[model samples]
Target chain A: MWKKSSDRFEYLQTLVTEFQDTDIEEAKEQVLANLANFAYDPKNMEYLKQLQVTDLFLDMLTEENENFVEFGMGGLCNLSMDPECRDIILQNSGISLVTNCLSSQREETVLSAITTLMSLLTPLSRSEITHPSILHCMLRFSLSESPRLRNLAAVFLQDCCTEEQVAQAEQQMQGQQTAVGIPLPQD
Target chain B: MAAPVGNSSGCWSVPEVYKHHEQRKVCISRPKYREGRKEKAVKVYTINLESRYVMVQGVPAIGVMTELIQLCALYGVVEEYRPLDEYPAEEFTEVYLVKFQKLTSARAAKRHMDEKSFYGGVLHVCYVPEYETVEDTRLKLQDRRRYVIRTAQNRAREKEKQERSNEDPTTSDTTTTTEMTIVEYDKTCDSDNTGEAQQTSYMSHYSSFPPLPLPPQEHNFYGHTNQQGNIQTEDKMGTLHNAIINTKQQLQKSTSFSQNSSDRDRGTEQRVTPNQASAVRFVPRTAHLENRKRKMAKEATEISLTDVSGKNEPLIGPKLPEPPKLDMEDVSLNTTVSLIRNTMKQVESVPDLKPLEKKIKPRRRI
Candidate 1:
């Protein structure tokens, strides 16, 4: 029994080290995906927390490569399901970084960002998460033509924020709204 | 963006086939330690990738929709099923979309049905999240979060119980490290009360996770420890037929409890009035737009009522105080003022009446 746990720890450590040492973008993406899939299992949550993979995922949010942002966002979305990992993400100021992905060109990335935001919700972080600007972004997303995006944004609005907040955001939207979730211009 | 798949009107639009639906090549070069029991492509599974609406492709076109649905019903209650006539398919094959009542049921159905051979056709199943409505998406995430939190709390409680039991043995020096490890290791070996012959092989590995606390009430209904380990060995041996036959029996027993509860809820729902039932089924797209418009209209009235100065105030900041009431020294004048004020309120409430009227119009038309 102990041997299996040690084997898992070693395997995760290998992936983490490979992610740091490899310069090739493809390898890094694969390893990032590997680590993220591992995070989905609750049994591996303690090991992932020990490896500081939360910080690794947070760092990927600001990269120029869209794949990095998407895969990393996906990893955080899965990891944040655990309360322990959610606290670590909150401590790292993950709210602002994840919010930046709201405007990503890739729909997968935006979807992951929305789910990660919902999972990152805590009493202490509620105000920042439900900030007027974020709510404004969700308001835009709730009207998105893509049903997946519309549904997730609706969940965020319905579950994460109060009805008054949504109403206020809607009112503000009519006069002047921020460009948070609008898609980036494609070259 | 993918088009909406189907609506409550029982009509389906052509669904855009997504990249995730195409299964990638199985990654084979992983070192022995990193490989899971089954070879899988390098893709991550998140809540975004899962849905109660699953798409099934490669079904034989020989009028087998009932047989296909019955196969799906083995996993859970099939809420809705329809063949996607517009979706592109291979020659002599068809595609179908099935919506299970619960996400877990969809998952189990996908796991069991995908890549399995049916009547002269191989089935390929994948989650089609684009087909879900906003309410379905919201309920899925809420249920997943609640399940994770509940399991985490249970695991933590079990750990605490194990620690307390270990502490009772020795109160002296070396209370911190070695003895605790030894005691935990010992418990793993001794805790296999399930003398099922199939479990004896992999019982050691399975013992570490679920039954760590050992005594009081661990072996009630969660046959997970029994099936998980035995299933793995069965997979490796290429006897999936036996593995499924053995596990399906146990899976159905555990899943039936949940099905019974859901069925009771469905029974109560059947008792609802037809109008209410239709309302629950058909959530109009215009509903959100109308809700927002209604709220805006109400806000406008509120602003107009509060700002007696008759100027639009910025929606932000503290609301303006109501204008002071005019007074008349004569009783006849005071009564006249009250009458005017009552007439003004009735006029002001006219906008509020519009929303209710609009609401009833949509319901009656549907």
Candidate 2:
């Protein structure tokens, strides 16, 4: 058991290093995606935390490459499922970074962002997560054409916030809406 | 902005095939250390990419829809199914939409049935999130989130328990007290882990205490079926026996296929079992069949004996032995005996005994 754990840790460390050292965009994306997928398994959570892969994922949010942002958000979405990882993300100010991806053109990135936001909820972070602008973003998502996005956003509203908050957000949405989740036109 | 590649529409429209439905090229250039158990495309799966609704294409249009659905039911309860008459299909092949009761069932079906041949055609299965109502999507995400949290919480408690056991040997005597303290600690420190903790401090909030880990054998009960789906070999009583138990489970779901495939499944099991290091003790198929036949014959006699006694018992006294008394040793046999007894009593109690006996006597004679 000890040997296997170490082997897994080492394998993850290799992926992390390859992700950093590789200049090829495709290899980086592949490694990023592999690490994100590994984050899905609970057994790897401890090793990922130890390797500071959480910070690695957080850094990708600010990258110019959209794939980096999407995969990074996806990793965070998986990692934040664990309470410890959620705390780590909260400490790192992950909400704003994730919240930034709410407006990403890619639906997958937006979906991951919303889930990550829901997972990042704690007594301290709940207010920030359900802040009116984010709530407004979720309200927009709730009306999305895609059923997956609309359903996920609906869950975020229903489970992570109060009916009063939702009603207030709805009332406010009619007056002045933030483009927090609205797509910006590309050149 | 690129239109997101998955289910980008609602349920009421013509199901447009999405980009995710196409199988991507497998990644082969990975260095030796990173290859998975199966070669896979470099794709990340988030909850958005999965759904309880799956679309299966490339079914041979040979009017074998019943067989196709029977194959699907082996994975889980197929909630609803209909052939997608308007959707595009490969020349001479058809497409069908299947809604599973659970996303996990759909996932299992896709994993097991995709690329498998049925009626001379291979199947290509992919999630059709486009077909989900908003409620379906909500429940799917909620369930996935809850499952992940549950598994995480269980792992956390297990780690804490191990740490406590290792930290002090004296407290081992007061395991219940130690557990209580841990639960107390969880309530105080890990309050955020429970989604409801901030809402209300009800006693039910303490139910998050980890369930006793399932026994190793019972692990198969919780949908670890796929992991153990492959048949194995065990040297019971020093003979190379074919263990086609998992295939038996699949066969039990669709009995029509069981007749021919029982032997074929056994052959597959033996062939798949790697490396017979023991001096190749080849047990003849006929011998195995004979052994099975003898055991079946013994069971048949036991069943017949119970049936005779069940009918001879008068209605007044404890109307058939306590269910335990009718135990046929196997659960399935016991169930069958109870069913027979119940029907027999029903026949006796109703004022229709003569006609019932007339119907039953011909079958008994046969």
The parts of candidate 1 lying over 4 Å away from their true place are: A1-3, A177-187, B1-14, B28-32, B166-366
Provide TM-scores for the models.
0.61, 0.62
iRMSD value for model 2: 29.0
The digit string of per-residue lDDT tens for model 2 on B53-72 reads 89999999999888888888
Model 1's chain B TM-score? 0.45
- Cα lDDT, all candidates: 0.61, 0.60
User: What is the per-candidate TM-score for chain B?
Assistant: 0.45, 0.46
- Each candidate's DockQ score against the native complex? 0.13, 0.07
Error at B9, model 2, angstroms: 15
For residues A51-163, write the lDDT of model 1, one tens digit per residue: 76777788788789887888889889888866657766776667767877786877788889999998877656777778776776777666555668877887788667777
